[model samples]
Structures are given as C-alpha cells and as structure tokens.
Target: MELKQIIQNRRSVFPDQYNSKPISKQVIMELLEAANWAPTHKRTEPWRFKVLEGETKINLGVFLAEKFKETADKFSEFKYNKIKRNSKNAGAIIAICMERDPEESIPEWEEVAATAMAVQNMWLTATDLGLGAYWSSPGLIASIGEFFTLKPNEKCLGFLFLGYYDGPNPERTPNPIEDKVEWL
Candidate 1:
C-alpha cells in the first residue's frame, strides 16, 4: 500500500478488538526497527522499548489493577476490571521510555517529541503489517517504576498495547486541516 493510504488506515485498535492470536517476535522486531529510524534532533535517539509478552503481560495487568484499586480517588470496579483485562488480552505490550540526555544538552521537550515520533513510526509499521496497536497512557504509569526497574535517567512514557484483531474499529473522522491553519 501507498504511504498516504497506510497513514489514513492507521487507527487505534484496542484490547477488546484484538483476537487471541499472537504476533510473532520477528514481526515485533520489524516494528521496533522502524521505530529506530524515526528522526531525532541532535541524534539524541532517546526512545527505549521493553517488550512484555505471555505471563509477563498478565503480571502487568495484575499490577495495574491492584495499583488502581489502591490509588484512584474515585475508581470504578468496571475501570479496574478493564485495566486488568486489557493487558492480559494484548499480544504484547511495549513499555515506552525516554532516557534523558545525561548532560542535559537538549531541552527535555525535544527528547519527548523525538520519542513520540519513534512510537509513531512503529504504529505506522504495525498498520502496514496488518497488525493492531494502540498507545495507552494510564494515570498509573507514574507508579510503574515500582513494578519495573528503571535507570536514573529513564522514565516511563506509556505502554504500546499491540495485537491482531479480526474486524474493523469505529471510524475516526478528523476535522479539516484548513480550519486549524493560519496565514499571516
């Protein structure tokens, strides 16, 4: 497919939409490789990905469910159940992290933007490969360090929940680009 077509077709397919079939490691590697090519300012290359699969995925679900139960000021049982179920349902979860430049050579926001572009690349690749994916940034990621080890310079950005789904998701219609543009 063409680039424009791939871009237009790329949509956030959620956990409930994902079938039970597992996406192979090699395919996941392909997406990661595409992520590696994302443009970086000053070559900081700040994105780091940790792949969670099988029992690890289930463990992550349990961790998030328990943490949400303990921390949310107004948590719902429905939300808690969904949080736990989502992780275990995924074919894989990529913990997206950003490693700050040790010397602080660049502004922090630049590093963050670069990391996001990296995820965008992976998302596009997944779409092209006929796989489903979505980036989920739950409030509880602030506490993820408790569940997973991290370097002093590293922090959790979010999780990329990816899998293979069997059908179409609801359509997302974007507003016209012209409406947001300004000419001086």
Candidate 2:
C-alpha cells in the first residue's frame, strides 16, 4: 500500500489476537528506523527503546502482575494472568521513553512530545507492513517510572505491543474538519 494510505489505515486495536507466529527481525528494524526519523527540537532526539521478547516478555508480565497487585482496585488473578499470557504471545514489545535534557532551553514536555511522535511513526510503519500494533501505557506499572531504572534524566512514556493480527481491520470514521479547526 502507498505510504499515505497506510497512515490513514492505521488503527489502535486492543484485545488483539497475538498469534504465536513471529515477525522477521528485518521488518522490526525497518519499523524502528521509521521512528528514528521523527521530527525533533534542537536535534535532542530523546527516544529510547527497550525491545522485549521470548523469556523477557514473561518477566515483564510477572513484574506487571506484582505492580498492579499493590493497588486497591484489585485486578483479579484471571485478568492479571490474561495480560501475562497475552504479553508473551506478542512478537515484540517496545518500551518507548525519553531522556530529559538539562542543558537545553527547550521545555521537558516537548521532548516527551517528540518521543510520542516517533511512536506514531512506528505505529504507521507497522501498519504499512501489515502488522498489528498496540500502544499501551500500563500506567500502574509505568507511574513509578523509577522502577525501570531509567538514567537519572530519563523517563518512561509508554510501550508498543507488536505482532501479527488475526482479525479484520475496521474502517475509519471521518470527523468533520470544522469541528476541530479554528478560524484564528
């Protein structure tokens, strides 16, 4: 598909059927490369990624299980196990983060914004490649950001779950431009 078409076709699909089939490393690299090209301010290029797969996926599940258990909402063992199991089924899990800049005059929010843009590039590229991708914050685990052992200046933003989708892609519903556009 054309690049424009791919971008328009992308969707956020959760409860996705993450099949056991694996994706090629070459395709994964291509998607990351797309993320690397995202626009940045002062060339800070603050994106950082940690790729999780195989045994590492299971480890993350266990960690998430423990983290959520601490809260009073009390997610059930079944729901907790579902996340653990689904995580393992994904072909790859990418943790997207940003490293704060102390010397630069730009605000910290912009750095995180740039990182988020990069993630959009990744998601679009994955769509172009016919892959199913879901970006999850898992706030319960991410809120304490320090637990990830980020560099003194780094912070976790979100994670992207990538894999082959076993379901149909839904059509996009167009919104009228006037609703969001301003005359100013």
Candidate 3:
C-alpha cells in the first residue's frame, strides 16, 4: 500500500476485532525498527517499547485487573472483565515509554512528541501489514513503570495492542482540515 493511503486508512482496531492467530516475531521486529527511525530532537531517542506476548500477556491482565480492583471504590465487574479479556486476546501488547534525558537539555514535551512519532510509525507499519492495532491509555497505565522495572526518569505513555484481523479493511472518514488549521 502507498504511504498516503496507509496514513489515511489507519484506524484504531480494538481487541474484539483481533483473531486468535499469533503474530510472528519478525513482523514485530519490523514494527520496532520503523518506530526506531522516528525523528528526535538532540538525538535523545526517548522511545522505549516493552513487548508482552503468550503467557506474559495473561500476567499483564492479572496485574491490571488487580490494580483496578484496588482503586475503584465500587469496581465494575464489566470493566474488570473487559480489561482481562482485551489483554489475553491481543497477540501482543507493547508498553510505550519515554526515558527522559537526565541533563534536561531539551524540553520534556519534545521527548513526548518524539515518542508519539515513534508510535505513529508503528501504527502505520501495522496498518500496512494488515494487522489490527490500537494505542490504549488506561487510568492505571502510569503506574505500569514500576511493574515494567523502568528507571526513575522513564514513564509509561500507553500500550499498543496488536493482533491479526480478518475481513475487509475498515474505511475512515476524517473531518476536514480547514476547521483545525489556519494560515498565518
């Protein structure tokens, strides 16, 4: 697929759309390679991806479910079940992170922007590969750094859930750019 079409066609495919088939390690490596090429200011290269698959994904589900149970005043069984289901259903879950520069030379936001670009690259690659993918930001995501054994300067941004999907590619209708953009 062409780059323009890939960018416009990319959609947030949820776990329910995912099939049970596993994704090959080579494809995941290609996605990471694409992410690694995203531009970073001052060469900070802040993006860090921690991938979870197989039994480890179940462990992630357990960890998240337990965290939600502890935090919610009245834990909704529905939400808890969905979290557990999504984690196990996904072929893989990649934890997106940003390791801040200790020197603090470049602004913190730049590092975040760089990380986002990296994710965008991954997303586009997934779309091209006919894989379903979505970036999810749960309320308890920030606390994942501890579970992932991240350094003090590193922070979890979100998780990219990936899996094989069947059926025709979904179409997207985006809002016009005029409303959101302005000429100087």
List candidate 1 segments past 4 Å from native: none
- The CA lDDT of each predicted structure is 0.94, 0.80, 0.92
What TM-score does candidate 3 reach?
0.96
Model 2: which residue pairs collide? Answer: none
TM-score of each: 0.98, 0.90, 0.96
lDDT of 2 at 107: 92
Candidates, ranked, TM-score: 1, 3, 2
TM-score of candidate 1 to 2 decimals: 0.98
Q: Please provide the root mean square deviation of candidate 3 (C-alpha atoms, Å).
A: 1.1
Cα RMSD to the true fold for all candidates: 0.8, 1.9, 1.1
* lDDT by residue for model 3 (1-184), tens: 9999899879999998999999999999999999999999999999999999998888898889889998988999999988999999999999999999999899999999999999999999999999999999898896686477998899998999999988876777879999899999
Q: Any idea what lDDT model 2 has?
A: 0.80
Q: Write the per-residue lDDT of candidate 1 for residues 1-184, one digit (tens) a residue.
A: 8999889999999999999998899999999999999988889899999999999999999999999999989989999999989998899999999999998899999999999999999999999998999999988999999999999999999999999998775588899999999989
Error of 3 at 29 (Å): 0.2
Query: What C-alpha lDDT does candidate 3 achieve relative to the native structure?
Result: 0.92
Per-residue lDDT tens digits for candidate 2, residues 50-145, read 887788877777777677676638669887777776677789888888887768668998998899999999999988888888988877655535
- Cα deviation of 128, candidate 1, in Å: 0.5
